[model samples]
Target: MASLNKHSIGGNIFLLLLAAIFMLMGVYFQWLYTNESNAALAEEIAYQKAQEEYHDSNIYYEPEASIRWLLLRQHPAGYFVPNPDLLFEPTQLNDNTLRATRYAISILYELGALDSINPKTIIEYVMENYLADIQSAGEVDGAVYHNGPYAGFGTLSSRPAAVRPTMDALLILNLLGGLDDPRLDLDRVNKFILAHMNDDGGFWDEHYAQSGRNSSLRCTSFALRALSIIQGHQKKGFSTSDRERITSFVVSTHDPASGGYADFPGREATDSYFVFRAFISIWSLASGDLAERREYVENHMEVDHTIDYLFGQHYLKDEGAFSRYYRDLQSVSSLKATNLIIWFMTSMGRMEVLPEKAILQYMMSKQNRPGEFGGDMYTTYSALSTFSRLAVSTEPMSQPKKPTRHASIPAYFPLMLFSLSLLTLITSYFTKKHEMEARNHILARQASIDGLTGILNRNGFEEGLEKQIGQAIRHDKPLALIMMDVDNFKDINDRHGHIVGDKILKEITRLMTENIRVYDIFARWGGEEFMILVTEAGQDKAVQFAEKLRKIIESGFFGIESKVTCSFGVAMYRKSETIDEFVHRADEAMYNAKHSGRNQVSTVPTSAKKDDRVVEFKP
Candidate 1:
């Protein structure tokens, strides 16, 4: 009887333990499934939120606020002062007076403020006080120019003709339809500008006699823009060849590695002003090749990268203003950087991406609210221009002003459940591990492939280029790099929605992959830009391949009414050049192809013909 009793107890305990184990296993599996589902849901929610923010359409811009800020800077003297509070005092004015006045007038005209303001009085004041006859001064053959403002009266003899002031005055006059003014002699102004053109195809600041300095980018930009405006009023302008030479000079100022323009040759440091001026100069000269000029700017300007750098290094995000340099928030707000950003956004047609409210608030903060000018003349001018641009932007707005939230549970609620289930089953460990591994694999794959086209991304392309460059250098084998961009891709995107545009890119990628050799490494460089690395190929082979690709693209059906075309640039790897320089040469060639005409191949010449670079191949 005692033996029976002991056995019964042992069996009961064993049964209980078995039951407990089974219950725990069930709990573990349930927790694992729930955790995985919750994680996926969280990821999806985050992605949706980000997408909503990125494409938010409820943003609104008030132009009146900006216009009010600009109007506060105006003085009763028919000119804009750096500080309106100083209007009652004897304020010293210089070239900026002319520039500010022009900017203010231009913005007012653009915003329909001219209806309220009497522009005739201002125009007359500027014409009578600023315009000077160069022939009378015996400074040049013919031309009337702005003498720039003087500190005291009867100091006209002391004031010299500067390219910037003259350009500003001329642009203002042109804007006001005052080109036909009896006091303004267009023929004389044209001759004066022509005489200032240096042998190097740039212009001097002050007729080369007053300043006696080398041709500067700033002066050249102003002079070229003025001449371009003059040409619009009259039929005559700089000859095409002369304009081409001027374009070459502007191109030479570009730093390929940085995608920024230097102030002059041998000066590699880039400033926003210099880059802006260089772009304007090229644009003015390349009037006939407008598309090519835009392409050139797009390829060389690196606007997006530069903006990132400026924002990272100099922009005070919290304050919503840019500083002059990195980490110098206390310094006066950098109107130059701020204005550059605005211009860049406008030119790139990316106004929708700007932080409109923040920028507006920052500008308002900089201005004297009640009775004073907010900043210097240029600062006010830049602020006015930036505001005007923001006010006139045509970007669509979202219907609803606020984003809708879909999730009710906290993101961490799954964690609490996970803790409770952790003590349950052994199989749950393996399941979680497997899920993590799968997620990592997906991430790695995504990093290598572009989301839009399923091709190698920019990071992947750069990695491939580095590896190929190392191989080419080690073996001393000839390698060629090819750069190509879809001609007028922006136009396509504008005409068709982004969905169709994306489809076109995917189709183009498929076609490229099918046509290129298996050994050739190809990747999407950026939006509508693709690059190919061809091993064991000389310049001739590269050019031939580029031409072949161009033809294929031109003939391919892109699901649009118009035929798709691409411009290609080819360059053979040089013995001493770095990878960036090599790529830049190819880019330059591509730019030349676009400049020459779309659907063509251009090659950078090898060592023997380095002087005769950028040879174009047309089909």
Candidate 2:
């Protein structure tokens, strides 16, 4: 009886162990099923969001193409050129203008492309050329404008740092994480910026705009941006009266007919640039949440009218580009105008109303090559920026919280379109053949432009040369003509093809543009040769200038695989000499350079000398 009882207890213990094991297995399987369900649900939501983002309406975003074009125009020293036709020419580092670099660097920074560039080289260039004025934007130092004022930034550091360029440089430095840089003086920069602000409650660029106006929306926006960056993100700097005065000043620049702001008051022509500057100043002045900015703007202006003006007026749906002025043709469409308008729209929370597909098409049309947007860094910035902004999500964090912002759109659409159409008809009645005349004037000027290099063609050069000669005669200035021709250029074309030769000429033109004085005349004298009229400079100075150019070309940038050289010929313009005689002397001197080996500057002795001889300047 004791053995039977012990066996029963063992059997009971085994049954309890089996039951616990089965319960554990059930819980494990249930957890596995739940987790699988959750992961599948998450993946499905992600796919839906992606599909929404890449839908038909928002398909114009081509970041890859925009980046390709921008990179193509980038100089080695981190500057940028406006023309891509000069892409393959030999240009020096720090050779291109700061204008394009300012925009290009800003765009690249926005796109998070810092890893692609050497920031140190760029920083060094900026410090030396703009801020410190060591090199002076690829010019010959501060020989001119020696008494330049407020040296924060400018095209040529020799000139006074204007409000626009100064603010642009500061923005670039900020984008480049240059705050830690010791060379940047926030205190000095703020002082320069503050100096531009007038009692009119607007910023004035004494150097940039000589338009006689004391202040403009453009300068005000630039000043405010620089001031904000220098002072940090605090709103305590502007007083209640200051804000009110500013609000009143900016509002006064607005045009009710076009629903855009002008650069100045008194109903100036309202365009994309002015409107953009006005909007930025308005945003910068307003603090707190994005909703507060919208509220502030609404309190001041008929914000819906601005929206309608942008959509049905400035934005040409048919062209996919914006006009610089209202009632302009689609052919007059500008990348700058489109960019500024898009920037404004994106900021105002109205991307849904844009013609995204058309804009993409127009932007891509400007591309000269694969990944090349075929415009300057300004256009590249606009194109790339526009493309990126197109895909921006209108999520809760990305946009304003007000639902009424969307509601106002439907009410303003029909009225805006009708007003635009009516205005166009009225303008046609008043201005008889006015638009045609304006277009013809542009075409006439473009006629003289060299298609190869944006410089003057032979015909254009002749007209300009005659004008300069007259100016020299009037000012009683000594003048010299320096003619330059590529060495072995025909061989380069024969061996490397005409395409390579064309690039060489373009490079030469780029160098001339950088080295020559702004007032000096430069032109393409046809083929691989160019002409320069050195005003107020005698034979000695002109010869030296030619030599400088010879060296620059010798070591300048080469976009191609082959090395290139040039021969220079200079001649002092004899008083009352025929243009042909003057040109012949310079041409003969150039051949003398070719005969005396390549890459030398040869000058023709004056006719007054007993023996007319060719004197060559060599290293």
Best by lDDT: 2
Clashing pairs in 2: 69-371, 90-557, 91-557
Model 1, 355-381: lDDT tens digits are 676776677567654211254545655
The digit string of per-residue lDDT tens for model 2 on 1-619 reads 7877788777656544543444343334433554555666666676567566555344333445555667766666666666566755555233236666778787777576767777776776566545543234432234433443334776554555666777767777777777557777666566566666667787777555575438778778888877767666222466678777777788888887778788888774447677777787777778778889767767776666777776666776667888777644343688878988888777777665677778877886776654445345676677667767776422223221222211222333333333434343344334426756887998877878899999888888889889888888888889889999998786678788888778778888888899999988899898888999888897778888999999999887767666688899998877778999889889988887876777899985334255454567875
User: Which runs of model 1 end up more than 4 angstroms from their true locations?
Assistant: 1-59, 92-95, 130-132, 138-158, 207-211, 292-335, 341-377, 380-619
Off by over 4 Å in 2: 1-69, 83-96, 130-151, 233-237, 327-331, 392-619
Q: How many backbone clashes does candidate 1 have?
A: 5
Candidate 1 weakest ten by summed lDDT: 148-157
Every model's TM-score: 0.51, 0.48
Query: In the order shown, what is each candidate's alpha-carbon RMSD?
Result: 10.9, 35.9
lDDT of each candidate versus the true structure: 0.68, 0.70
